[model samples]
Target chain A: MLMNDKVPLIREKALWMRRTAFTMVHRAQLGHPGGDFSAMDILATLYFGVLNFDAKRPDWPDRDRFVMSKGHATGALYSALCAAGYFPEDWLQTYMQPKSLLNGHPNRNYLPGVETNTGPLGHGFPVATGIAIAGQLTGATYRTFVLTGDGEQQEGSNWEAAMVAGHRKLSHLTLIIDRNRLQQGAGTEETSGLDPLDDKYRAFGFDVVEVDGHDHAALLAVLGAAPASKPRCVIANTTKGKGVSFMENVASWHHGVPNAAQYDQAMKELV
Target chain B: MATVTPTAAGLQDCRNAWVATLEQLAEADPRIVAVVNDSVGSSKLNSFQKKFADRLINVGIAEQVMVGVGAGLANGGRIPFVSAASCFITGRALEQVKADLAYANFNVKLVGQSSGVAYGELGATHHSIEDFAWLRPLTNLTVIVPADAWETAEAVKWAAQHDGPVYLRLSRMPVPDLDIPNRTFRPGKAEVVREGSDIAIIACGTTVHLAADAAEVLQAEGIHARVLNFSTINPLDEAALHRAAATGAIVTVEEASIRGGLGGAVAEFTSANQPVPVERVGFPGFLPTGSTDWLFQEYGLSPEGIAAAAHRALKRKA
Candidate 1:
């Protein structure tokens, strides 16, 4: 769990992420708010209390890596990076605008903290597995973390990467699944069932950890833990569109835009 | 049978040179690593695996992960050479190659072994004829098709030293080394094997030597044919192409499909910049069951066939 003094700070960061992300989505009118809200707290916890990174020295060889595998949730990732001081807060205003560095997906070249370009599902896990293998090969002390939507677990490429991470025994790797249960059109269960997700990962030789995704203290508790003998997989159970009451658990908000009234409601509820 | 007779050096597979150069590079730099998709034997990396056991990552028939791992290894400061069969490496994990390596601009080298019709009898699925077309659009990638073992070794050395993404398309088909006096590996530059005024015969990979032999055939017929070993496909040596275009007639040869290999690159360049009668010698599409020799002879990849194509282009020019 997070220290008593840091828990409040992390909680405050998470609230800011929700508000900022919602604002970006409202302005853009073309953002994945449902997925973004579900993943924001996890991003907040990692940037504020868990991950080891220097925005100034972003290319530091020994820096820990956090790959945002669920890339469409740029609202969450951009806000967290901005808060971490990777760039000025004003850059967040251009989120998804033409020629903005904050693309629909995260690009490592354009942005400082993005580990790799990931818009297509199932890409992040394999790239992150590769990063972990690099650490293992050189005996490097840096850790690699990747976050994928539970819905994205259906992509065959993820399983392919899981096997590599397992076969190589990449102990320094951690995979966090934002288990919000909803995909773009429908529930993950209705679309493609991933209920035995934890068991599948365990079968792939990852130590499984299930956590309440929105709870900053619980998130810190599991995310900040040391590496186990096997690679780690954290299934972060969360509600889709968690912060806004009207959008909560609604599938249409997967890429839904908010009108003026709804925007005001979301902004008020985000706090 | 290959058009060229056995030289004093004898027949040598390019994979041998690839592994040898990789071994040397690894010895010099600890950051050099090899990632494969259960292709250690096919890629001729058995010795590499033995020497750098911990560094050789075998992702067990997983091309997507193998490429992604290469990009990841580069991120960790290791220059990774990801090797596999040309067909699988380019087809199976194409998106991974595009996003992780090319689009992301990772410092990785992708070695495509047994390119073209090396697996001739194995049928169309095993042939990597479409690799050029598939990969050509990704401008970030450097596509190098080495002609012989000497060029193969040089290309590997160059890839290791260069700090960007590259695709080294190596053929398993044995080829005699080009008889150039002072050879230097200038990527994106065509090698002039023979000088002539009547026509220019452009070839890459296993067909370069055949183009030279075709030049000899044309020479005996009072048609002095210029032979260019056009190795790099992506960055079309436009300077050399301009010179070739000045000759008024050209014959482009390759072991790949005519749609997008060297033939396609030449056709695209000449049609727009310098309109000339260009004869493209390559496979039209899928091939019937045949050995590499029979396919080469049937598809005009042989010296006589290339010479005939050069004649046809000269006729069109007149």
Candidate 2:
């Protein structure tokens, strides 16, 4: 059983991840706020609870690999990395600044935690497959997890990777779909319905599981469960803009940074 | 140089040379392996698959997965030569090549078969003329175009031994060998096939033999021309180019698009360092369907056409 003492601490860590996400986006004045906020809790659970990585040995071959397939939500990843002590927390303030480590996209060249340079849709899955395949070859127990956005799933490449993952029987790899219903322009159903997403993944030969994305207990339980045989896929059903009162489930916040008043309100709500 | 035997025999495609050399390399070294996008027969890698069954991983027509698997194999301490049709390998998996091979700095060797107009009958849809233009901008990726079977063999051996990202443009067209018997292939160096001071004919891949034949014609006409076999496109031998520029006139030729092929590379070198009368010869724009030979001749990538360009460049030279 998971230590009960760690449960309260995970909530604190997740709240910190949320605050860091808001602060970085507010500082950069440019970020995918909706996706970042929706996925923050999940990222926190992985970094704090599941992932086995040390800031000192960032490139350790045996360490568990994490790829942010929804690379536009790099602000969330940067904040998580900082909270994990990979870098200074103050580094979040330099988001998108000239010569700063934070770019519009996560560059593996500049950042220690980023495994691949991703910004284009459907890019990270294949790369994560590569990392996992490497582990299989080396007989290492390291696991690779990739998180992709609901809109980004429309890219044909993601499906292509999904098919390969199943065909290769990559039980060491896990694909987490941040199934937030809303996209940049409209709700995913209104834009392009992905209602049968769970079935689609199951048909693709993955062992599929559905869970509430925001609930820490459910996310931890589902994410920690090892695959029985085939590669596992967790459909993290989520709201587009989660946590903040007015922004939740809104599509406009996909890339819209909160104004000063909204920022204060968001901070107050988080507190 | 290989002299064609008068005996009636079927010509061997250079891709066969690529696979044969790959198998030979694999037998000698356990690390050498082949990666493909379900293109085992297309890339002439069936012999390799037969010999090393488990090593040939057919990624099932997914170019992006093919590249990623290559990077993964490289990460697993295997020297993977990822083979695929040039159009899909370079076009579909461009970002993967940039990230996994170039950015991640893996030792994955990308082998792009049937480059240029080799897929002539398949129409412009199958052509890979823009491969050089797409790959030249990226750092840590060496691009090489071998002129004939001999060069292709030498290039494959060199790529297997050399540790970094390399792209070998293995063509399907047949040509007489341009290298001396048992000559070692050097990375990032140019080979001066024929010597002349009036004009320098710089070419690569199928065009290297064309450039040599063009120099032969120029010699008969009392217009001497130097033929430079530019096998390595990137990390170009600048000193040799500067020496060629001193000859007053240089004509660059290739089967790729004129905008970013051999001509563009030479022009970029000369414009900044030593400007001279340089004539660029390549596919000028979009082309229609035909056989490889017909397309090459139609686009003036032939010996006679190169000779004419050299003569014109000589006339334009100060």
Candidate 3:
């Protein structure tokens, strides 16, 4: 659990998370691999390094809450759940199967650690704010972390939540924007520019931090710091498809499942 | 028993009842939280917010985020009632309502204030005529429209005790009391305000009293019109609707749009199970400007309008 020991372990776990995500999407025949792969490192780092949660008790009142606001990245979340021991690692294979609980979107009914169901954009941030407010009301020490896609930030609701978080001064809440720059249709800049994103959050009363999203050491260091009297937002500048060569920076891979050859190439890249 | 006078004398806005009930609940249970979308005064929650400052969450004019935050509060074990204007809460943030509250099956209560045409002069942008239609199709959501202050209090209590998601539409328009002094609310069960066999008038929310007045007019015409005040729309009292349809003629009324409100619910229910002649009374579409009372009269929502619809449904003339 020491910082020196945790950093390398989280990186390996991130790699495993990507591999499992790729395998799950391949089996499901339908999933978002681009954002999942892009966000895997942050997910791994959260579950392994920063979150004060035990997978055994997903509903622990005082446990830190994690919301996948960018819910299309369920592959990354499910993979992190496996690594965090919420479910068996083998459960990843059943993802998006006819009746598999591992749906394209994170479902709280079937999955542990999923605070809310999200698929349509800009849904999670407000809920994350709620979690933070609940903690404040109950006097619980647990913090809330919400991971949203940079493109998903375009949905207005996220800014609304940012305003609320600042107005309420939810010091225990942290928002991590997966600034992979790419969305399903195109690059976030081409679709709808979210640049000056960090400034936007800062103006909304957050203690903003810009970090390398894929670097576990830097993420852990930044996230480990105590939140000030206001909510903290970490704009993690990231690259889509972090591990795979062909899929990296490719917007078409946003939801396209890897074929056998591509899957193999992804698996090789992870190894 | 107060004999259920169903009178609007000393009528009170149900939004006030919401604030009173919410304040009472917050006092009793610290976990009871109210979340509003910068509608503190609009939702009549300023008193509650002042009393329980920490418990009131004003997300500042964002309906989509307001609902999502309510869901998150539920996730964190605080029972949150998200309060917002009905038009924006249901129309603007509908997907969040579907995914966060219903699909996720959270224990959040959605309080939609100023429903129907309460904001009449504000036009369709502020009138939530389509809420019933938008929410009717979602599973795991218990939709309730309180007819008066007492019903609003009862519904709030019921929603707090209930274990799942619920949508409670509280009106700014004043309504007469529907319940006895100590009457309580029962979700999914329609309250039969008056009984007759000639024809049945099914109504909910602010329009229930209009239906009663229509029944009185029908009685004057020697037509014993049955009156059913339905507060719960989603759980649609199938048995009651069937019996109403069995009466051979049915007139349904609501403060919402005719397309998906109580009338539509009844039609959808009776069409599949027991098809019958039905007259749905509500806003058809394309709203016009006026005061609430004026709009209600213009849209044929007055007692005379209900009676006319009843006559249309029951009369045997070609």
Candidate 4:
């Protein structure tokens, strides 16, 4: 767990990550900024305070693995990876550009910190479950973590993986759902209600926990806990766009890029 | 009506051979693990599970998770063999196969058991005639349909040693051992069963034996049809196709659909490279309920049907 003296610095880093995510999406003129902002704090806390990894040796055998199941939020992941020194900060300038390693979705072949290629929803969760299974078989102490969007849970594959993970009792695996409530076309409630989400995970045999997604200290505390006998599911309640006022909780902002004025105002507000 | 009898003396089930080879490979390598979807009995992995209890991962009927788990195991430096029924593994988890294995280029072997109408009486839902069509287009995937027990064992051994994704299609149907013992299985290479000049009969999996029988029948009639067994489908042996084209006529056969199985691959290769008189032999649509033998005969997948197709191709030769 992070010490009290370092908690403020981690919060400050999370704020910086939000700014970088916004800039990447704004420059690309394309990206899921809403989910990016929503999951920024969780990503920052996992990379900085929780995950046991080495940026220099990304493929370290015993290192903890992190998979971003909501892969549309590449901006947030790229910012976190850069902040963790996985790549030079200058790489951020070429996000989504032609010949840039930074694609709209993370490609594990191109990126070092990326554990696997994920774009299609409900895929990373199962892959993470398999990784956790491997960790168990090898008796390795390393853990596996995956982050999924609230809307992405509608995919049936997630349930398939959830059932197996629960049945296998992969205690080393942690699944974090960025519950922003809004999806692409409408709110998750209007589309397909996932209320009682914590209960649903608990039924799937997970040790469920809910947290304020933006609170860095809370995220660190919850994510840093040791594994129990069952898989852990962290339901991070969040606003769709955490730092931007106009985009926050707005359903249309799920993929809506801010215009010049909106972008300017958003940047000023973040500062 | 003229009735045709299978000429091969002894027949062996490829599934048994696959399991035998899998056990040998697993015993040799500790990194080898079997990931199944509660298909241990169907995949002939009961012995493997019993022997390597800790290594067998049965995900209990979840095909998507089974494939994903295989990919994850591969990432953790374990060679995962994902075994399941072909219909569910390929049809239900097509996206996982595409993303987790092929596109990601994971070191996993997908063992699709009971492929190509092997479960004929169970109905069309259980038939896996579309596996070739489904898997052929995916890049970085080596698609193989071994003809018999020997080929299946060799292919399984090759897949375990190979460092990339491979789909090994095994059948519940018993097939004659066409391959010589200790022959090395190479991907993208076709084995010539017999050489001739009138017309070439190219086939794979269940139809390879039919092609061989057809070649014998044609020889008695003085047709002298060439026989080419194509175990590997995706990285197709174009060189062999060109050699077959020299015969001026070709008849392609498979136990799968004519759309994208061995027949489709042969047509695609021949039409573009060498314009030859070609006749394709295989099932066209969803198979009706029947015994495996009845379905094979009904769909013109028999030896007599293949020989007739060869006769038609010989007529078109100019």
Q: lDDT score, residue A14, model 2?
A: 76
C-alpha lDDT values of all predictions = 0.91, 0.84, 0.87, 0.89
* Each prediction's fraction of true contacts recovered: 0.77, 0.36, 0.93, 0.61
- Candidate 3 similarity to native, TM-score: 0.95
Clashing pairs in 1: none
CA shift at B26, candidate 3, in angstroms?
1.4
Per-residue lDDT of candidate 1, residues A12-120 (tens digit)? 9888988998889888888999999999889988898888899999999999999888999998999999999999889988988999998889899999988898988
TM-score of each: 0.97, 0.93, 0.95, 0.96
Pick out the ten consecutive residues of candidate 1 chain B with the lowest summed lDDT: B1-10
Top candidate on TM-score is 1
Q: Residue B230 CA error for candidate 3 (Å)?
A: 0.8
Which residues of candidate 2, in runs, are more than 4 Å off?
A: A1-5, B1-12, B24-32, B72-78, B103-106, B161-163, B181-184
State each candidate's clash count: 0, 0, 1, 0
Question: Candidate 1, fnat value?
Answer: 0.77
Query: Sorted by DockQ, highest first, which candidate order results?
Result: 3, 1, 4, 2
Residue A194 lDDT in model 2? 82
Q: Which stretches of model 4 miss by more than 4 angstroms?
A: B1-9, B179-182
Q: Deviation in angstroms for A198 in model 3?
A: 2.3
